[model samples]
Target chain A: MATVAAKAGEAGIVGAAERLGVPLLTYAAADLAQVAVPNPSAAPLAAVGTPSVAEAAALLGAPGGELVVQKRKSAMATVAVARRRPRGRLALVGLGPGARDLMTPRAVAELRRASVVVGLDQYVDQVRDLLAPGTRVLESGLGAEEERARSAVAQARAGHAVALIGSGDAGVYAMASPALAEAGDDIDVVGVPGVTAALAAAALLGAPLGHDHVSISLSDLHTPWDVIERRVRAAAESDLVVTFYNPRSRGRDWQLPKALSILAGHRAPATPVGVVHAASRPDERAEVTTLAALDVTTVDMVTVVTVGNTASREIAGRMVTPRGYRWQS
Target chain B: MATVAAKAGEAGIVGAAERLGVPLLTYAAADLAQVAVPNPSAAPLAAVGTPSVAEAAALLGAPGGELVVQKRKSAMATVAVARRRPRGRLALVGLGPGARDLMTPRAVAELRRASVVVGLDQYVDQVRDLLAPGTRVLESGLGAEEERARSAVAQARAGHAVALIGSGDAGVYAMASPALAEAGDDIDVVGVPGVTAALAAAALLGAPLGHDHVSISLSDLHTPWDVIERRVRAAAESDLVVTFYNPRSRGRDWQLPKALSILAGHRAPATPVGVVHAASRPDERAEVTTLAALDVTTVDMVTVVTVGNTASREIAGRMVTPRGYRWQS
Candidate 1:
């Protein structure tokens, strides 16, 4: 897996460090050894701009000091941070869509190399050991909107390597928007894709995303109800192999049935839908059910509903939508 | 690299032939024995579904002109023709995307073992003796889509070991489709996914397909134009990183530019679009061009355009769309 190190590493900090011919500082001997001479110059100068009182102390390595200084730029021109890196590398590292081996090697490498890791409380614990010792970590557990952004921005500004991790591909409604909005322009963000739940489900029961497929999220937490409805209508009309994410949660169990109605047009009432829960993770479970037999209340946020394309059928015990080749044959 | 064996081998043909449960016959075999093969009963049978016309009449050793007949069941359970005594099996394969190293080991092994080979004209020519001789060969030239499929199906049905080939994932827009379509359902078709072009392009372009990406083809030769338009509209509205296949041709170059006007509402004109021509194959070229600068006429069928998500951008001559995460100072 070729790392999209981009400006995030090689041409960015490492390049600067190389040009200066100095070793970037690190508490870990591994990171330190990874560089040549320890370049103390890479160290933060005490009067660097944009030091909130708290941060000035941190940058100065002033232990136990918390002064409230105003936020300002860290360095003029030398460190023109993006609004946060437009391509702040994001690795949507899939822990599994269940077993770790199923996790692609690329996902493992990104996790091991990330400097600052930001993610949900669950993911932070999942691959905690992969982190290099002494790396700073910012864990957000159900924080308010601005709080998440503010924390992400502050860390990126700190010059510490940071990774905003998410289970599955972070781009799949898990990390893309919020992470982008918070990190600002100077930081380059890149999303690491993992095996998506739909792919796993398809693989488990033979290829399902074989032909024209569409993945839709049922929970309308952030999206307007009308938007969801319109998209579902459009997908159904297109006869797409649809996968519904965020199918149900506490108090949101009603989402599935409502989704069925919105998609009633194209799919026959008896269309096959595979309800997968805890995909690729321990306690993983999956069941094949038809659209008419689907019981939304039994599902939760962990469940991903895969509704087959118009061609899908229940064969034996599996719900499969042959990618048309079967019919062609 | 996984050899997505043609239907004849994958289902039960190989096993049957190995056990001498069925008869087998092949058209050409210059070197039939260097590799390990499970053998069977009588002479190889006629290839399935294809007419018993040209090849069978001219080359078959059977003095009685016996042709293998298929036992078709339900609409979907059909397989290719069955030989009376099958001596060997051939796997039609596709190595998705490029990066030869990414080729699946299974595909590599099968190719290594093939005594006789058949592939698209360019592929057969490119491999340069990837097969051992005296290997009989059938190279399908351009605009000979049906011809290639028929040849592969015919060869496999005859029971001579062969590997039908495709680049990138076999199941997605590769030889697997036509091979199975024309061959009867009784023929066993096994799909081994190589790296899909989208995944390879995404990996090359620094996580461009992170999060919600869509793989949409601009080709409307076999598919209806209206269907193509609807998918395009939905992908744009959903803000997906769209991968366009067969984006242009001599007569159909207008679709790409037309797609721009249709998708502009959802995607910013300045959004980063990576135009990759002949990905993975030698002479592969990729350019980080923005949608605004894209000239449909300049892009031909060889080109694959990834109209990035809202986050995609051109940075330092490379196309990148950050999944969103900023690193602090």
Candidate 2:
């Protein structure tokens, strides 16, 4: 190690130190593979409650199967050991925020092993280069979700490794549900999350969500406009930190304005609003303004908007959405 | 373009076609940077009713100068071009989910250039070796924020290019705030966002956050405990999607249980809940369960708990937190 420093510069030192840390860390993708439980039938008959805790104990040494489900006052419970190969097989993956560079090693690993890839247009586009020559790609729009679900299920049932790709972390507001809803007893699926846009954009704007905030999407596809609008109003009325996803569409530009009107009712017009578009992508854009000047028209499918809660403070030219951490402490 | 098939395969043609679509793409970084407002003293004046939009334009594109304040319907009256070398600089950066392979080219570029990097002990520790020889490392602990803030300010004012790094995206409950508060007018701070934990975990979970759901932090630190409780209850009551950050602290394990109690009000005991810990890292762990089986005590600082909204559905063994984009068309 000392000789390495003599031969290399600061970058070399960084490389050496990093290598040291890697060895100190215990890593086993296989363990995760084991935890990739697909069908409950094949899963060990572990009780769901305290008895399950004992089962969880037996599998403590395993990888992804350590289910830490915390009931109110109960002790932590671990699920069963993750099997190496479940009867069913499926994968949910995130493509990172707009850029291929931000995709995680895990996501890449899953993609490499996947025989069938299912995802939205943008997500598939980002990782288009990685798909194997004969890899089956399922191009999907927002509609026909059930079809995609059935397709993934059929592929998984056939024992093909499948992956459902989302642009952000798949668990947040994306495919985790539809995939599960569309699945049957015969399939196994594992999730691989990526960077979400709100977080990506918040990083660009100096931590608008550093503390407590509400993240809501202005898009009203499945949700009633009333419900979406009410949620926006509720977030604003509460003075909670807020983030807006799918804030506007060419057909629904007015939604943001009406939502803003609701926000203006409770939030000071000057509430800081951070807008980041194409986050993590080469052409990413970010801007911080107040509720009064939020331009709904400029934001589209690719944009994410974060509005400071009442507690958010603008300090030294940057915005900090206080999580109320200091107060709690 | 024909050879593109050789390079991009099926995805290449799809991407090329998508790029050419006649959609009204909104403004991204390019649009904002186009109008140079040199010397903050001179810049375009924005009209009222859209401060968030216009004020953001001024703050981002205006020359480094003293910000002028203004107030409008959705804008801030006090917006102006800033023209000055920042006395203290803040860079809100996201580290993407772990592996250097996942690091965005832009994110990596900024890290190599940073002179002072401040972040939580875990995050700082993760990237310690990535810094240059002279780069000062400041450990920012979640528990001891004041001390962290002071150090961040002190270092930046010392004229060091600082990288405030965070795991996932820096903006999502990461490093954006401390730098904002500690620095002053002289600091020249900027933000570099990375992948957010939620997104990374979601990717791992296969698009759980695929739709419009509410994101909330279980940590009561920066927020009133009552408020945290309220939001959790409200999110559940509204049958809205919910995510819990800082879900379980060694000292505050009870928060999760309390949250579950409220969430159970809206969701079934079988309502799906996904838990992700140390996502994208070699130590990454993930699983799926329900509100009934959720045990909050098992999670820690590294974990994110996502509770599905009513529309949240599971299919093909994958969970989908539908953002309802399909609801739009």
Candidate 3:
């Protein structure tokens, strides 16, 4: 049971909390003034130092919950109830590979449902049109993932519906992992999946992933190079189709060639490789080449390099991996 | 240049084709009668044994292409131009984990744009509402993937816009491979990537795929059990997060247990395992258990079993694989 500080000692409210076996919570006028209520008036503020006593107190008592009932005025007191949701909602949404049509409908809906939307600046700009009016957007530049994760979690903790957006499927080398690491069971987390770069690139370059495949990110910003290399070697030894994300950047150019060399050690020099840049976007470009023939210099941060397995082939102009080992024509 | 059999040898048309250095192709009335044209007239049927010869010949001439112009008649001759697309377009669309909201806007748009749609009956039913009014749907039951692939390619080869849909990402253990194998350079193919089962299940079960991951389907229908086991072992030995698709079916219950045993060899018994059944659907159910605690009997064809890597942990009842190798509180 909750009430204003002036009514905390009142007999009627105190008796009700005691009878219900619930703790009585009281809120200060200044604190109550911060909460946005559906209805507000001057009478309670002038007489009791708060515009809303019962409603504000109810909301203050239920952290990360919602106000279910409005104030009911009686002759001497007003009563309200706030329903505590099991937890606040935090939707980690994936915007897909930089195209409006490629984004899932659920991702767009979650953006509209959220009271707070957090993402990197460029990614936020991609979906700004989908957000409803009054949606609060907290956007930052690159390398601020940790801060964005914490901010999204905090907003959800405060009972706001929050959406933390990332490009591609949020779980695959994106925001979901970082955000989930910072999040606890205090909030409900819903992951909305999207088209990752590998799938998008594969679509453009035919079906290089028709069989078993592994995706390894080459960025050593968080993970070490040794770990990335070991995974690449395993993928090569096992003859699994490999999709390399974050393959190269201006600062990290050698990794892609070294990784391709490891794949070449296991695969024939002529094994097909598909390189896709900015898939589904207007400037999207895809090429099918051989492992040995690929010029790593043409690659960059946005490029996805897919090396086909032993059973993979180039039919006509598109790279294709047979679904079965028999590999019939 | 195209014309009906009656006008194939016309002096003016022959001279024009010769002057333009283009070969003139003529279609028989029987073949022209088979093609459905936008404009059908009784005058042509009565006079030349086919309705709308100009439109039909143009369509037949540009196999898998549309008639760009309606029939224009002169006193003695009728002419029409059919623009042949470099190739027919075949869009391998992923419907995304059985939820309409999870379906990408591009997937929906592809469904609307397609003149013909081919898929497994259940997947087709999921997107029937999104198809344009006159769209042709070629739906079949399970195990008819080969036929569906052939039909979609044949439609595109004839210059029709086609969409071949699967439940998850079509390139991942779906129709893309078979369709691509049958498809030559004669048609344009677009892959509209969808949220694959692995990504969809990962989202529902926190972030089990936060780090490096590999997806291997356990169904030996197309792949041999030995190949599947080898891939599973590689995934386990490398500590790569693993997502098992087609984990179990009534007739194939043994594979899931065997695959789990392979992972258990390297992973701790308490390693987190997320089992998601029919993710994002009304009957969707997800649970995070340990490697030893997971009940394979609870899994089915529709289920996705994701086993976290060595770096993965169950935090606050959600499975989370840290993005980095170093552990932190």
Candidate 4:
């Protein structure tokens, strides 16, 4: 295995290899001191035998390999990307709820940086104005999530900078999962998280998420009802504020009612529940109700339902879960 | 209680009142039809025999009060803000996890909109350049969090737009709780959520938060250690990925170790743990290691520690928890 070594004191190198899907190779100061590198520093030369651990390791690992990227520095670490060939990039981006203002600057930059953007047709429409003038957009309809993930990875492997976009935090119940499953080490993958639906809904509903919370999808498309029910039960039993994504749709009405019933079993019927549909969007609709009064028919695929814990309070009209111990209240 | 009524079919009025910390008031068409308003519409008159629902409701509720804001139309609904008096505005803002790019545009807008800004001295320095010209900054040192919250609220009450900022999501273990606790319905309060520390750290560590997770603050300054321990125990027993905020400091080093031991009892020693210090800042440091191997000394108050659940895996050096049932993985 190709080995890489850094100053013994440096901590991220081991995890960096794990991120790059490579084995870490460590060398003693005296050993790395002997290897001549293309670029080196006096600090490392003074601390270790080698002037550059990253460059020296690459040279040592692949005797004839070329240094593709010179050392790039982050705040505390230096990364020297080395490969035998050119590499493409894949960025999994979250668009944040539906509002343009909710989108993180980094997510916007990634969308503009990518040569090709892949996402659901509706999501593409949501961010179409933010894309660079010449950017290519490949959009599909719903139920093609797997195909979109595959296409994004394939484009990345073909040396195109591709951004696979989703609404809300992409890593949370979004495209990051499917894309990561299809991705390999041949491409550089970056995940830019967006404001998730749970957080957005919580914000709209006051501070129901002031304390600990969990986000569970009630879609039951890929995840079974039993599994979703178990998670709901766990959250309910733990006094956890729960945010339900994909809470309901035309066909999925019963699932939400069932899940709410499961939660109702654990807490009082008067527990505050917030339902936000199309958060931050033009058609945004949000309301605070009780578990007993929450009408499941009002929810849809675009809605996020937050159920407060036993300690949560309906103050004025807003649902607030205080960040203090119940005893304090 | 004075009653204000809109069309009964309007779906968002109840939720809007809840968000505004007010009670929903309803009036029948005939009742509102009897009142006169500034802007009369034939449509509402024909449909419900009311000239305007919002204006009529405001006029009816506060019989002698003025309509402060004109009726505004959104895509799905019309809103007319009415108040007994001119109120100050308070926005609890999150600066994201140290990176300028991670900050949402709404957060930036809030900074620009605020006539006064309140935050920790260091945090103010981080985003001082982003503030609009003429904005007054009230910066304080650590241990004065309560003081800052009071100052922000006081400033807002004085009729100035105030932004109380904190790193990562302000709502998550930051200033939102304290400030909200100090606030009343007199002033308009808006919470602009940011990329929380846990989410930011999770992104740098790959998809460790792909599944459900809970964030717990290990700092004992405000919360008792027994409460923290019990919460940690609940997380461990629930098999949820736990993200520890305020994980460790020079004097508080023992809490993380003790909490990790509690987690170790429920999970294998090999469970992946991600530690990110000063995430997205110039001094940022991130690493992925097993619970058994994580060195507690490397963590400090600036770090966030995420311990994965039993199903989390170290793939290619990245920590990932699948969103599916155990059988699928």
TM-score of chain B of each: 0.67, 0.67, 0.77, 0.74
Q: Where does candidate 1 chain B have its weakest 10-residue lDDT segment?
A: B32-41
Question: Residue B3 of candidate 1: its Cα lDDT?
Answer: 13
Once fitted onto the true fold, the runs of candidate 4 whose alpha carbons sit more than 4 angstroms away are A1-84, A326-328, B1-85, B326-328
Ranking according to TM-score, highest score first: 3, 4, 2, 1
Order by DockQ, highest first: 3, 2, 4, 1
lDDT of 4 by residue, A130-211 (tens): 8999999999998887788899999998888999998888888667766776677778988887788887887777778777
DockQ of candidate 4 against the true complex: 0.28
True contacts kept of each: 0.07, 0.66, 0.77, 0.41
Q: For residue B131, give model 1's deviation from the true position in Å.
A: 14
Worst 10 residues of 2 chain B by lDDT: B1-10
Candidate achieving the largest DockQ: 3
**TM-score of every prediction relative to native:** 0.57, 0.66, 0.80, 0.73
Q: How far is candidate 1 from the true structure (C-alpha RMSD, Å)?
A: 15.1
Pairing residues by index, what is the TM-score of model 1? 0.57
Give the top-scoring candidate (lDDT).
3
Across all candidates, the chain A TM-score values are 0.68, 0.70, 0.78, 0.74
Candidate 2 i-RMS: 3.7
Q: List, residue by residue over A34-73, the lDDT tens digit for candidate 2.
A: 3323332222233221222222332433323343432122
Clashes of each: 89, 141, 3, 8
